[model samples]
Target: MGCILGRHDSFVYPTWHSDPLSWSSPLDSRRGPLPLSPSPQRGEGERHTRRRAPSPEGRGGQGVRTTRARRDGFTRKVLAWYARAGRDLPWRRTRDPYRVLVSEFMLQQTQVSRVQEYYPRFLARFPDLDALASARPRAVREAWDGLGYYARASNLHALARVVSRDSDGTLPAEPEELIKLPGIGPYTAGAVASFAYEKPVPAVDTNVARVLRRVFFGKRETRNGKREVWQLAAVLVPRNGKRAWKFNQAIMELGALICVARKPKCPGCPVRPVCRTGQSPVS
Candidate 1:
């Protein structure tokens, strides 16, 4: 598929409905219990029926209204899948902004499997923003040695210093504030804002955008496809910030596992009802 940028073994590919959560992470019980997640309504396999969805008619008041219903239905299906089948990655278990930041940086065009091994070790060495910020550049780079993108490491370190200095050693929750930091572009900034702060902003990474392309437009985007994808992403996010965080996670996880780039499991996909392409084979 045209939208298939990269697919690594870091994410779980659920083959069975009853499969247990199977993403790896190092133990760090000292971080305390994670915050309770809002429960999404559970969908029981093929028992769920198809529903009417929004059309691709662009930019009108009535069109926007119809789209809202479609997005809500889409959100429910994806979140139910998330609740039932989402990967249990280490970074997902914590709400700490620093941990989220570190994970997001490592995950940029990188595989999840490689990142799971490095995340805790990196955290053990530099437990908080203060620790990362205060460390020497070489030491930080050394810690990030295997992650490949040395520039991300450098920028992450730089961001740590800036955020550590500017905001009482805590990363900012606002996308606007986050973008000013080194290496924190729109995607990273939206990620932090949504994943860390639970803001209802679009975190349109490759995975999320890929899902949107197939579900709404029914094929891989071309030319201005990527740009249009981001705009749609911003529009699709739920207005309720309460659901926003889970919404972002659900879509991304859906893309990563089920609605994947190549050989997508359209038959088992949760959003099949609303997906225009999922109506037929996802090829």
Candidate 2:
């Protein structure tokens, strides 16, 4: 139950599994879809078998890989869970960068229900980046009236104009390029890149960050702990772009629906077995 810190002071917890694929669950796809609600906790007598996992570098030291042991199993479990439980939202159905961009902009500092109400309506008014760029600022603001973050509206408009003019109405596919656009930050940029372009990058929004902290770090982090979470996220993402897209969305969805900000349903979480916090006595 000891802990170690990397050179950057990011916490890495040891896991017991020797083979990432060795772990199996009754929730396997062959059996059936997972129930919507979490199952009850196990009896006190039941516990997982333990075996020391090898470090990424094959030797332990200050620079040991944080995600080496957990990455494959963690990604597999989350992706499998998502295949069964993920919501079929409108934005999730498309790879259109403009549509994804709009969703990201509306989703910032706003609730998903409200965004659902306004998303189709706004998209109906301005169908693409060109349409948004061509519309007057007043019209754009009017479209964004209920979303509340008026500045996001302004920034979205600015971004549309910039991208429309410069990129020939196509949004950038890299986080680095996307971040340069208006209203888009690291999270939004990564979202756009992965969701739209299937880029294998990390997007550490509030929900994703919480899941990463509790599951990987095994404790609550300070408000400024986002950088460490982002690092962990980057390391954990699958190298394959398609799998990475699913991984990114799966983690975010897990955070929003199961591993919520308060009263996280750890008992039902797909990643619970490998999760530091979920496996801890306190959870």
Candidate 3:
């Protein structure tokens, strides 16, 4: 398994160890690190496999272009961009499961800046599952003031109580298990699994969805194309849970900062050549 080199910033997520054999080696040494086995060589056919479905005129017996190479190129660009430009957030500072869980819950339908203010305070008040589970719902709600999304606060309280009682005061590390908790959906589950437990599940948020769609599918209209994007995301995550964490974060950061919804800074984008949407101005 190949290693993933994280960004230099102190707040960036920590470097993930994919395999014991490669653990001691430098992260930049890995070449063509595929989330799946036997990383594929860079080529045209492989690069175009991820492009959009053929148009009606190009359908029938006509050959359809694959975007596999473009996907690989885009992935590399995004990863490189991520290594240099990923954000520094409080939750990313630690690999603690509780912190990741809290961050994920608070982040739903909320901005990172807003969540930042509430995160430390909430953690300070609850500290751990035991504290949260033992605290009154009203107290939890009080701590969640200004965060809005009252449902998140309520569900978090319910989740804490359940986790404390059922899991012996421990949060499950697996995505499947985490999904069983209140307020945890597929995205949150994948996030906690990858960010907290280093699982290889893909977490597709709005940013990731837009970036993947534009870079791989070349389709600006993703309103009805999320499923395909998610499938592609699943295929892109390395089987190694640790590397998956880096891959997931890198992609999300790319979407948030570079492959933005409007006037994407594609010129400076690492995956510019592979992107079918044309070159970015920043490049």
Candidate 4:
């Protein structure tokens, strides 16, 4: 696929699909106590599959087996690479949700180096959700000067109020809940969930979208490509929740540093072995 990247209206996928009540209703309504059947023992292969089922994606879903394997391999390679090569970012050093949220907002249309200088100052002024919520919108906008996306800053200020009043000054840990906040959409929700709360959700940005298109789908183009790109990203998150942060960061770092839109350094990429595009330099 020739990497078709564009902004689209963000859609949130429901987290819980199966209702336990629906499954238990009829069985529980029986007058007499129902005899419970012993659970069948799975064969060795089945056991192995069950054990390894949680790919970078949460639980294995239909048509996701191959996607999970590729993502797992890619995640491991990228995280390993990140451990040695990842940049010393300010947000990486903190576990605070507010800081992570700020960095993510700044990073929407701005570069990391540029965000770095402003991040500390911004945080220094509006150190917490309460601080941001209480500050004037103009002050926040003024502080966000040079970062062109005025809407993001505006939304961030609005979100602070929402979180402060509605959420009781705590940002929700779930991606679904985060998306309900002002200025937070699919990508930002996923990024905050994975990066801040250690939830295994995929945050696919332009760089991530390009890296995925090139590495997995090769050069074949498809309709609704961006949605497919996000689906691929969601499946690749590591099952081990603790590694979700590292995994998400590694991919973003790879896209930012190695998988440059122009002149990608494929030869030096750790996941090059699995990359279908091979190690050829970008034309």
TM-score of each: 0.75, 0.75, 0.73, 0.77
- lDDT for residue 13 in candidate 1, whole number 0-100: 17
Error of 2 at 19 (Å): 30
Q: Please, what are the lDDT tens digits per residue for candidate 2 over residues 83-196?
A: 999878899999999999898877776677778889999999999889998999899989999777587787788888887787898887755556556665557767888999
> Highest TM-score: which candidate?
4
lDDT: worst 10-residue window of model 1 = 22-31
- Candidate 3 Cα outliers beyond 4 Å, as residue runs: 1-68, 220-224, 280-283
Residue-level lDDT of model 3, residues 224-262, one tens digit each, is 254455556766776787778888998877766767766
What ranges in model 1 sit over 4 Å off? 1-56, 59-66, 220-224
For model 4, state the Cα shift of residue 118 in Å: 0.4
Task: Name the TM-score of candidate 2.
Answer: 0.75
Task: Estimate, for each residue in 1-283, the C-alpha lDDT of model 4 and write its tens digit.
Answer: 2222222123323221122111111111012222222112223133121121133232223222245466668877988899999888789888789999998888766666678889999999999999999999789999999877677787788778878887789998865456556666557777788778887667766677878877876666664455456666666767667787888778877877888777778778898988866545566
Whole-model lDDT per candidate: 0.67, 0.67, 0.62, 0.66
Clashes of each: 1, 0, 19, 7
lDDT-best of 3 and 4 = 4
Question: Which candidate comes out best when scored by lDDT?
Answer: 2
Checking candidate 4 for backbone clashes, the offending pairs are 1-218, 1-219, 1-220, 56-236, 56-237, 56-238, 57-237
